[model samples]
Target: MPDTKPALSKVSVMQDLLKVVAPYRWRIAAAVVLLISAKISTVLVPLLLKRIIDALSQPQTLKALPIYLLAGYALLRFSSTLFNELRDLVFSRVTQRTVANYAQMTFEHLHLLGARFHAKRRMGGLLPDIDRGTAGIAFLLGVGLFTLVPTLIEIALVLGIITSRYQAWYAGFIMLTFLVYTGFTVVFTARRTIHQRRVNRLDSSAKSRLADSLINYDTVKYFTNETVEAQRFEEIMRHWTEAAVANQKALFTLHVGQSAIIACGVAAVMLQAGSDVMAGRMTVGDLVLINAYVLQVCLPLNALGFVYREARDAWVNAERLFDILHERPEMEESRGMPALSPGRGEVVFEHVSFSYEPSRPILRDVSFRIAPGATLAVVGGSGSGKSTLARLLLKLYAPAEGRILVDGQDIARVSATSVRSMIGVVPQDTVLFNDTIGYNIAYGRVGASQEETVGAAKAAHIHELITTLPGQYDTEVGERGVTLSGGERQRIAVARAVLKNPPILIFDEATSALDSASEHAIQQELNRLSHNRTVLMIAHRLSTVVDADEIIVLEQGRVIERGSHEELLGKHGAYARLWQLQQREDMDQRAAASRA
Candidate 1:
């Protein structure tokens, strides 16, 4: 689960939205003009109806029909729809552009965030948050601007007509009805927002669970835990279903309450209008007018209620998105900082100290220097911080205590991107994109020609194997390159490094997971790759580091020994003990194979 930050307030969310919409303010103004025109036209429809009715009701009016008034009535209705359509057309660009801008910002921000941030987040949950947030922005902009504003304008126009042409009491009664209905809607929707948030949380949880299970599909199959995975997924879905039902119930209650209030208000207004007509205080046309106005006002009140509720939900969703934008990237790239100056890849780690958490230190006062084109290997057991050294050099993390100098420039003073561009890394596990082999190789250097790509592949000795495949270099590598054998994937990684041709390279346990034959083959390629490049090799097996220019033995975050393999073996210290143990294990394995 990713760390959850406090959500932005509704006002803050609106302010952010305003900034996104600022570029298209002229279009928004045009839409507003169209909106006002539409509402004015809509208000005139009832007025026209009242006039037509009064004309027909007159006894002498049978000979001269009110053709002009009838035509105007139809025109007003058509004009209202036309204006609304134009308003949407004018505003569509702003809405879509705003969504696109925010979506791209959030996407880029996620990439800018640190490794720790990603390590703590589940992609399944993060993706849904972004999707809902963008959608929420669109909904709020559309409904808040067009639906809510238009409804308010229509209400005001209808109320002004009622007050001017009829008794003050009628306007007062309608106003009171609106106030009560709005008050009820606000209170109920606020409570329902709680339910909506819960539903959203559970929905994210279910998605995260599904993604996690599927990502480890082979692990589950090997452990025969299909039932266990299914049961866990069902548990999350069961909670989601309950939350969804509760949300629906809240919606139903809100809608029914709104309808009941409108029904009572309409009934009372009609009853009073009927009484006034019977007493001859008001004509039939006036009675018809009040009825039409009341229905028109009340109907949009229902829509207003819906739009208000949706706006609240949209605010909730948008807040989640804004939370991502609010997250400060761990390494803030300062403006005007120079990129790393190109040099002979001289790397120096000076008394570096670091800890992911304060209490659990991974490195302490570690110091080393690798001159250009020299290979330095750090050999250690599983928790010994060899990998952390590589990470520090790459600028994935900044050392808590000393500074790292690459080409005599403090990496902290230069662009992290530039530092990374100068180095090529072949991690222990090579996780490729789910793309064609050619595409994956081309990722090493953007815009590399086919000849260059093939040359690099051939240099890594994987080109012949790739050519034998049915689709050749175009063959699709499944998710994370799982379709390829470990050796094949390692070769692809080497190919990528070869294509990059960086001045410095880091091989972090590159052959640690392979069988003896595969390890021997890949080791040769790795040695070839290391030629004429500054190399940092982090290895678990002592045998692999014998040929390194210098071998450092790490034990619990400290360098226990440093020497050439011959010097360390002559000394008969920790390095010698590890070498003898590995040699015995290798001989035993060979003997067992011979016996078999």
Candidate 2:
């Protein structure tokens, strides 16, 4: 099925725009006053020129030359320019503030959105929409407000003057020309919209492909598929090229048709005015005034046609961005929800059950507890719901059937930010921001001091390694910490968590990415960091959990064994079997190492 949504109504888009402009209403009002004054001066300039031309044509009027009229005409032209510039100067603030406000709102809302939404969305697609949306807001505020509104005002004044002073035929012909020009523009611009929309879609897709391909540059090089990736991108670009050409052709047709209508209207008005002058019913100045009005009114219509076309695409882009703002987070809390205040870091999963979908349950009636300042290890096979427990505790996903509590308070009643703020986590694959080593570590605590950051690094046993580097703590960790080895990145993750110093901590296979030597070395640091903290250890390497206070072996979302290492080993059940298997694997690894 094609993914299509109805575009927002024009009234809704305008209302949203007005809301952004609400704070700057006074400035906007002032700008409008200046705009009207400017147009008045502009319209009167043509009248003054007409008087000057008339005076020049008559020998008696030319003797004095009416110096005041010429001076007034020049002054009016200058005032028009001056008022227009002043209007822009006042209204530019509204445009800038409105765009900045919307952009910031969008930024905050994107972060408020759920993990599922972000996981499904492409960064490349959202970025261009955001950029275009802000640009659209600027255009709507600046050009749409100034150009479209002023043009309509000028046209109305011209039509009213003609209806009041000239023959009915002149007014009738101008109205008819306007209707024809407008109808042609509306119909042609609507057709052009189809091509513009296609161009926009292809442009977004091409950006997405470019970003995706570059992010996976290593994978592409490994598979030697650079040519294939380039070919795919070229295909998207080719489609965009064809759509752009079609859009330009439609624009040309629209402009040419509008110009023809205006020309016919101008010719009809001029011919009638000339006939009146020849009949001695009107002066030569009357003909000149009529011609000037036609040019003034019709010239702005050309700009109107262009603005109308561009505004359609801008409207579409802005609507798409506003759609993102409308997306409600999956786990948004109530407005007055209380923050989580953990006294002892006591975590309890009471009959907890969860699933991404109804039929695919990841955890079923699973329950566990960790006493204050105690360590509970969860050992499980892949897809056995170990990580889901950590995510649930983090409030990234809520349990479908039961409640999770911290310090006897149901987490559902507290804010997710507060819940997250009270706990620290180190996941299996640590993805660092492309920043300095010190910056990535300090991210764990928002306002940690430099000394505290270094202390955390030392606690994580990475300080010595960092000191050996050329830039030390200031060295740049390239995208996702690609410049650092897996062990180094994992250590940095540990340093971050250590810096946070949360009462509740979860090590979700924290050492899984490390080799035997690195794991053994970092294990000491992990042990030290877990001291006096309530910890949940989810691991596949059973050897690391041997000294854990309690071990729960999970399989298919069910806990099959729970006991200490020796006690579970004595049972000869799931824990024993896994332990024996890992024991043999470890021995084989050691034997292979010895031979090498």
Candidate 3:
């Protein structure tokens, strides 16, 4: 197991965040400068007001009130607003670009992770985490940086001015008040985090259940379990509703506690200022200035309290995403590994062994070789490890006991991307992206020209059907090609593999979903596509592999018989038994269909 670190500190999180902003350093520097300038302008406005008030209180000087001071006060206020807006304008690009970059990096990293990780994690749950993480990043960049940092600077400036210019009592009261307010916010916000995290988890669970149920809607309808699904979904929502309420209550405690602290601080300052003014020791301008400073300081503290609370949750969400990025892939790219070198398309598996879980071995000491420009078919019953061989050859899972080689290179030593580039597969289950028919086929070979796409479709016997659709080649294949028939979808998958035109091809039960007529048509196309290429065909139906150059019957991860179509049948072993069984099933199916 990988080592886990203790909870991360806010400062540590912030330091890590700097790496993301490093590319946009100059813009960030500009934003920081603007922030300081804006705060300086804001601080000076109250001081200008002090001067204006003192001038007005003196009857003799009122007639000669300085217009420049009055005008400068207005300009400073406007400049504060202008500088803040300009700061946001500069920083928006940094925040947006950083979010996009991190999102893209996460996407690529997920693809790099092992298939095991995807199998264990639900797609619905994973997607919401990603969305929340990006949103957290945005909050930190825009609100936390802009609001929290500037609020601190403004507070420090206010405290410094009060201590130097006013009586010690004024500064002391403000400091004590600030410390009390901060202490309360820190303690109560910490308490709120528990509720916030619960809310996040509940929300994620609800979304996960909803998405899973929707994805399996057909199964639910077939089983008539709509009410059961609805009740299960309601259970998740009930938990979420309770969590939200608890979160709100915690928020109420934090805000009310903070308000009480601010009230005490403001009342103390006002009482002291009133006494100083009545005793003729201070001017009315001093009283007004103190009042203005109190409001300025405390209001931001309120906003800062809320921001700090929200930022903690944001940090938690972002950390979850970062954790996923940190996961190690099952297969690592060897440093300086060269790409696969092209040859005669020979594949060799030497004493390969593998298991999805250690307790249940899927393939044991499996050895096989396909000569260059040859077709080798593997036949077996369900769970006999036939498909596992294809997965091992594709390098989806590394062997536990042996190695696989492609074109004389140990596949484990070469880059997987390079290995897959030379091979094409038509999976047992055909799933197309919700896109145009042409786009799905062209996905096999990115940058394939329009002519090449249409040619491959025509070769697969799908071009004529596509042309008849209202949108022709541009017709949208609804999600997972639900709009297309089983045969139509398989034909599209065939077209994709054909367009790839790789040196090796794998058809894993490629025609299992088709009718007899469609199967005959598709089988002919598959044969033509397999010509002059190394092919590994895996099928449960014995008839599919009867014409292969060589055949191997695997039973419980062991090859029990090997020969040509007639040679295996002559033995009357596992291969012959399977053929006889399938032949009888075919006859029965034909009789049943005719009767119906």
For residue 390, model 2's alpha carbon misses the true position, in angstroms, by: 0.9
The true-versus-predicted C-alpha distance at residue 524 of model 1, in Å, is: 1.3
What would the per-residue lDDT of candidate 2 be over residues 332-386, giving only the tens digit for each residue? 8889899998688999999998998788889988888899999999998999999
Once fitted onto the true fold, the runs of candidate 2 whose alpha carbons sit more than 4 angstroms away are: 1-13
Kindly indicate the candidate among 1 and 2 with the higher TM-score: 1
lDDT of 1 by residue, 373-462 (tens): 999999988888999998888888889999999989999999889999999998899999999999888889999999999998898889
Model 2: ten consecutive residues of lowest lDDT: 1-10
Q: After superposition, how far is residue 293 of candidate 2 from its true place, in Å?
A: 0.7
Local distance difference test, candidate 3: 0.89
* lDDT digits (tens) for residues 71-146 of candidate 3: 9999999999999999999999999998998799899999999878887888778888999999999998889989
Runs in model 1 lying further than 4 Å from the true structure: 1-9
Stretches of candidate 3 exceeding 4 Å from the true structure:
1-4, 7-16
**Winner of 1 and 3 under lDDT:** 1
Error of 2 at 106 (Å): 0.6
TM-score of each: 0.97, 0.96, 0.97
Estimate every model's Cα lDDT from 0 to 1: 0.91, 0.89, 0.89
